[model samples]
Target: MQDCFQRTDWEVFDHQDLENHTSVVLDYIRFCTDNVTRDRCIRIYPNRKPWMTEEVQSLLTARNTGFRSGDKVLYSAAKANLKRGIREAKVAYRRKIEDPHQE
Candidate 1:
């Protein structure tokens, strides 16, 4: 939890709320979402406060310094690996469910 809080780059959220919201979105996205709707969803808004908070995302345009290129590359690789692992796991899970002898 301490490590997660220290990682400011990621959106820290409650596990239950995040999981529920994401499941809802993913279920809906399978059918309803299109390019325009996706764009609208990506544009984050805060109801109680201003959207342009300095501690988070602001209206300030970012200049690409290319300083974090290595970090970005590593993150991309990690994400790809994670996705592959998830897909393989899901496939194995479905196979086991279909044929319990393989379980």
Candidate 2:
């Protein structure tokens, strides 16, 4: 288990690696925990308002797989994409609601 943890899974682990890593690890963990039917962990919704949104909530549910804020509790690479998607969605929704006529 320790070997698995210490293994060089990220041959090119970099800042972008961490940045792009968030959603990969997130989903992998989710897939694992889901298989076991356990709520392993939770996502950080610094401001609770966003998490309440249906879109946000769905992603947050994906975060339930298991992990700390900056750790891969499951698969690789999925974490980054997931976070980016969620962030963009939130910004888009906020803009759409704040000024429906602007866009």
Report model 1's TM-score to 2 decimal places: 0.32
Give the winner by lDDT: 2
Q: What is the alpha-carbon lDDT for the whole of candidate 2?
A: 0.58
What tens-digit string does per-residue lDDT give for candidate 2 at 2-91? 343455366433446675677676665665556545343557577676425666566555565434444475423445546866788878
After TM-score superposition, the amount by which residue 80's alpha carbon in candidate 2 deviates from its true location, in angstroms, is 1.8
- TM-score of every candidate: 0.32, 0.33
Write model 1 residue lDDT over 1-103, tens digit each, in one string.
Answer: 3443354343322346877768765654443434223332345455633222342221121212222454676556555555555566567657765885553
Residue pairs with backbone atoms closer than 3 Å in model 1 (clashes): none
Angstrom error of the Cα, residue 70, model 1: value is 7.6
lDDT of 1: 0.45
